[model samples]
Target: MSRPRLLPWSNVDGNPCYLLGDGTGSSYLSRVADNVESVQLDMAEELLNHAADLLCDSDSDSKTTSPQLRFLAARLTEALRDVHRIACSRGARLALPDGDDDDDDDDERTDD
Candidate 1:
């Protein structure tokens, strides 16, 4: 697999870290086929399948020299996309612990 094999898009509310140094210089994206996260497990295959397609087809003009690389890339792209959709789609405001904050608060805080 090429570098950055494909990772579930991760959103960090805190400082982010990477496991640099896997022969490819960058960290290879890893995920268990059977994840404990029900959400990931539920959509893993579909997401990877879509990502695999995306990896190959992201650029219409770029001729894919390797089918294996294309498949891996597509699965990664799709997995990241799915992870993004799952982890990021909150309609703007992520309800506070009390679940009682105005939606505008989200925008205002982010703008600051």
Candidate 2:
């Protein structure tokens, strides 16, 4: 008999997970292993905290950010703009969801 590997899940409400993967199989373990890349995950967490702290509007009792946070916010703004350009170049278009009454009458007219 072999010992089962360990897996840490996100929630107390979530079901227990047992991940088993073959070298090339598209299994849950493979995906989780791929997603849990250490360096990239650390960078992502840094970026998330950076954006959340700097970009979010301040509430009544909040304090100002340090010099580092100011620099992070500027960098995050630039990165977001670059992402927007790439999304636009990839033909990403935002449209109202099906049967949405959100658009104006003139906006709804199309050549048919």
Candidate 2 — which pairs collide? Answer: none
Q: For candidate 1, give the lDDT of residue 60.
A: 43
For each candidate in the order shown, give its overall lDDT on alpha carbons.
0.47, 0.50
Q: Give residue 81's lDDT in candidate 1 (0 to 100).
A: 61
The lDDT, on a scale of 0 to 1, for candidate 1 is 0.47
Taking all chains together, each candidate's TM-score versus the true structure is 0.30, 0.30
Please identify model 1 stretches exceeding 4 Å from their true place.
1-65, 90-93, 96-112
Clashes of each: 8, 0
- How close to the true structure is residue 40 of candidate 2, measured as C-alpha lDDT? 40
Question: How much does candidate 1 score in TM-score?
Answer: 0.30
Query: What is the TM-score of candidate 2?
Result: 0.30
